[model samples]
Target: MSPTVDHYRIVPELTVPGYASDALKAIVGATHAAVQANVDNLGAGTPSRAPRFVKLLRDKQIVDDKNQSIATTNHNETVSALRDIEASMDVNDEGVDSSTYGTYSVAGDAYVDIEKAVNQLQGTINDAENAPGPSVDAAGRQYWPEAVEGPLRTACATTAATVEQRMWDATTDIQRHAEHINNSAPDNPTSSGYGGTTAPLTTPWSGHSYVPPADAGTIDKIKGFAANELGVAETGTNHVNRPYNIDDAWCASFATWVWKQSGINVDWSNKNYVPSVWSDAAGKGWADSDMSSARPGDLVVFGGQHHIGVVVARNGNSITTIEGNSGDAVRQHTYNLAGGNFTGVIHPPAKTPVNA
Candidate 1:
């Protein structure tokens, strides 16, 4: 026999009143787990539990007294029981009441996420800098599609060398906990201390002549390669699905496949580009530039850095751009607005920056 829990207030959700305390932990765990799990698996732009869970918890006196809704306050005992639980939550960034848990402030949550993103970016830059080149051609020009510059200077990579060193030095001026995340740390022990940076100075092939594989045959072949090799996220639904809709966005995966083919190298961790986020600078976006200025074969970025397309022909407002995840296969679209998802364009190198 055990002492019965006397209810000062009613809990409609939990029939067994004595066991409600144990269930409280599980609900909190479920809510928190949803957030952490999204960060661990999805990486960006994921939603968690909706408002109903919070309301139910509030009504049951499972949250803290301060956080309980005015409705929950109708019962005096419910309000009193939640007081301790809310106190416990005070230690964490998020505060909880007897019946409900509060989320972190927008700025507070963003800080930690930015930190993880920087970690990922650093590892990527390191790998790209160290990745081996394809081979040196007869002209003696160094040819490594994926090579990145290291923090320290080395022989094979000059442009990457400059970029790494610049990114390294740029961190000195950054302020606040979140702004510091933009600058990935340096290997130099001095840089690890507060107020340090090594920023990107020069891009790959900035001054060198980087030659892309010239004899890829034809533009149509590239289209075939893009369509056949890459998954275009298809327009229509499967056997049983919704109609072809704007809700479908296949821009990132298309860009990833094209970048691989062109060899304008960068490190891709998951191999597939994440579509849910417009940030991360990973998708097919470009900067604002005139149609006439963009050359043939230049990769046009769009959508604040989301979708990308390859230029084929241009005539003032009308331009033909090859895209993988639009209309049908890798086909051409014409428009002055650049399909509305416009951001910027990145021109692939015909010759190394040093040589050109």
Candidate 2:
């Protein structure tokens, strides 16, 4: 630490004497030690604790400055802030106030805690290097924390990163576990079915409709209209090599037919872009969206060489789409699993569309 850039120097008047120098020195020393410990954190096998790097920052404050009071102040401030943040992470103003209530708890402290954790890491690491030694704890486990000049820092860092990553992985794991449980149980169905039949979730379902499909066979009825009634072309595609079969990959045509049956208007003559009973009519784009106004029969078109489907139901990432050309079967399928040849979807025009 030769020719250290005096932080107090920048604040001219503070460089005068005792108070300024003392404060600056204390802060600088604490900061330096924190950095050192952080470096040690980069070690292969090093001693560590939770509030992980945060604890290191507080502990090192004392080690670097030998000022117990200062360290305590810094540490308590951090801890208090952390706790407040944690508490705040889930706030609800719905206390005796109807307008203030919400469907879910607010992000009371996550934003703050996450920010503090990040700032703590940056503040310490930016100023100093790692501290040293073979770290041992009561548990008798050893770690290679980054020492001021040893290979420890790398190890500690790798470990911290690993732990952080693991934490992230755990969150995903929880979500996946929940998904698995949901998938495993038949009682807690995945998607809300059209007529008491649940399917896997995929896209968003928002609008509430009192009218169920006039009939489950409504899906088939729509297709029949497109095939025998509407002048829809039975176009073939070299999409995957062979040609189009009425029984396979006829998703676009099937959807086109269904949209028309539900009283949703589609420009059947327009082959390049299928006239969605929804988008072309309702005006919802892929940009920023708000479907609070979307109705039941609106067409949700999946753009790509004219592929489309009908939105049977809408609830984010869990849409119920009725389609025809889905791998050789025309049935209701999930949006999430809509892969390969499956494109986007079309919300059909409601039962009241003029041209529908």
Candidate 3:
């Protein structure tokens, strides 16, 4: 009577047929559709939602990792290449045969070329390994891989490893070839005339004649004779010659000894006196007043004709001499011509004719 205040009575009117069942089915269908829509939107979010700096850092890290891997691989490859080169070298005689490389000698032009190439390759590796580290730009961005790209990448890119291996192989082959040539070479070649009919005298001075061998008067011969007496000293156990005691100053005697060894007939009353040698040289017309014209095998008088020695070598304004009584033993000395009281240089006579 009060306008259907009981709601149960209204629902019962709808339930008279399949009305309740239809309402439940409609509600279940709506729920299923909403769930499926949410599932479709999963994993579709943008990275831009994150901070800009974080994104930049992440990208930089990824690039750095990749570059590091590249650098490591390059380094290992370079080392392996070098090792391969070393292993290919052979130090045997067959390796250096001229027929092998179409060259007579392994130390010739071909070897030089190989050496240069190998050195260049090694330099590339050294440069890359020692290159500077990464750099930071104005905006806090980092940069690397420049040096690696410059030398390392270029060296390892092409047939460089093959070239390096070949170079090393050639180097070893040449070394072996050089050894073969040296071993097979004659002790004295025909050009040197050492073992030929025209060979110079090899006999020691017999004192029967004052004439030296044809080659004995040369600068090299004089230096050789003086060099032989390098350690000789005035010792009581062994003296060089009579009237020339080891205790006494033997500079003049040493000069005379060298001259005698060279087969030069020197007549001196007092062999211990330097002035005597000078006077004898002057009388023989062997004295050269100009110091600049001094040659090897020439006599040099120093300290007012007090000390004397044989000139071994000369350069502009400087001279090397082999002297006795220097530090009480025969030794070489270098002097400046401008500072010392260097007297005239005396040239020894050329090879004297042997008395027939």
Candidate 4:
């Protein structure tokens, strides 16, 4: 153990000429060595211990140059402070903390311990960096609050941005996983009942008839609403209601509901009829056969408008969608762009003063 020099007083007036100087030098050297040893052990130890040690060292003023053998009063206080800190650190024969110091009680809880320790350190750093500084005037009106909160606020803002990006990535992963599980299940029971449709079809557009607006606010709302409806199963047998008061075959109604809720003035004349949606879009020059130009929020017509869904994503030859009344629930689907079932895509026009 490094020697405790608190009891070894050094007053230049009372001691021999050169003796006090030598004694103070020896104490300072030993204290410095003990501090270095503590730091080394902490760096090699568990994560939480090192930061706590650093914080305490600063708090106790043991790491200050002003405490190094100044006058009798300051020198004695420094020595005593060093003693207190060394004891707290459980310094041993090697001038290091106890072997078990700052260790997790259970190895399995190490991750939790490390996380808590990081949070504690972060809080301290934030507090130190954000509080009003000495430069602030007595009235506290000289500088902006942002200037005082700059470092901590910046740290939190950056962390918030990263967290948002990660959350989005996680949502995408969950969507893909749900799609995979739904795809692996048996064919949608309600999907096979589309053969009896008899609505007159509009002539399929040969090329792009209308380009969607540049802003994506409405499209984002459409996709958001559809995503929120995932797993909303039909309440009872053929009793699905996509706000159409319908009992069955509500795929078109579901698509219409999503569009209407997203602030698009969709035709509700034949809201439950799949082909009615296609014909309206066709007549309004909103229909297109180009799968490559398809986008989220577009109504995707399947089997020549025999069935319909709201497009949520498109990648190469793969299109992902959400359709209601599929297996008696709102379910996600991913189909090939060149698949036989995919007939066309529709870009609905937004109502005036579109929802922002």
What local distance difference test score does each model get? 0.34, 0.33, 0.44, 0.50
Instruction: List clashing residue pairs in candidate 4.
Output: none
Give lDDT tens digits, candidate 2, residues 1-356.
11332211111010111222232333333333333222222120111211243234334442222222222335455444433322221121111112211122111122233334445544443333333333566787644332321222222233334434433443454346435533352321112221123233233322222233455344444433432222222234312221223433455555554554545445642222333222333332321123343223433444332344555555654455554443233345444423323233333333433222
* Candidate 4 residue 195 C-alpha distance from true site, Å: 16
Give the per-residue lDDT of model 1 (tens digit) for 1-356: 00131211111121111212232223323333222222221122212211122333445544433332232223345434444333332222121111121132432354354334434433443454345423456886553321222221121122212222322232222123223331232211111121112222122212222244445533433343443322233335311121212333444445555555554443433223332222333233333355346654455655433345665556665555655444333344554644433554554443412111
Q: Put down candidate 3 lDDT per residue, 142-252, tens digits, no spaces.
A: 444444443333332221233334434544664464455434533212211111111122333232323435655355557777766555544543254433354456677
Is candidate 3 or 4 superior in lDDT?
Answer: 4
Q: What is the TM-score of each candidate against the true structure?
A: 0.30, 0.25, 0.36, 0.38
Global lDDT of model 2 = 0.33
What is the clash count for each candidate, in the order shown? 47, 58, 2, 0
- Alpha-carbon deviation at 142 in model 1, angstroms: 61
Give candidate 1 misplaced runs (Cα > 4 Å). Answer: 1-249, 268-292, 304-306, 337-341, 349-356
What clash pairs does model 3 have?
96-177, 234-246
User: What TM-score number comes out for model 3?
Assistant: 0.36
Ranked by TM-score from best down, the candidates are 4, 3, 1, 2
Error of 3 at 212 (Å): 11
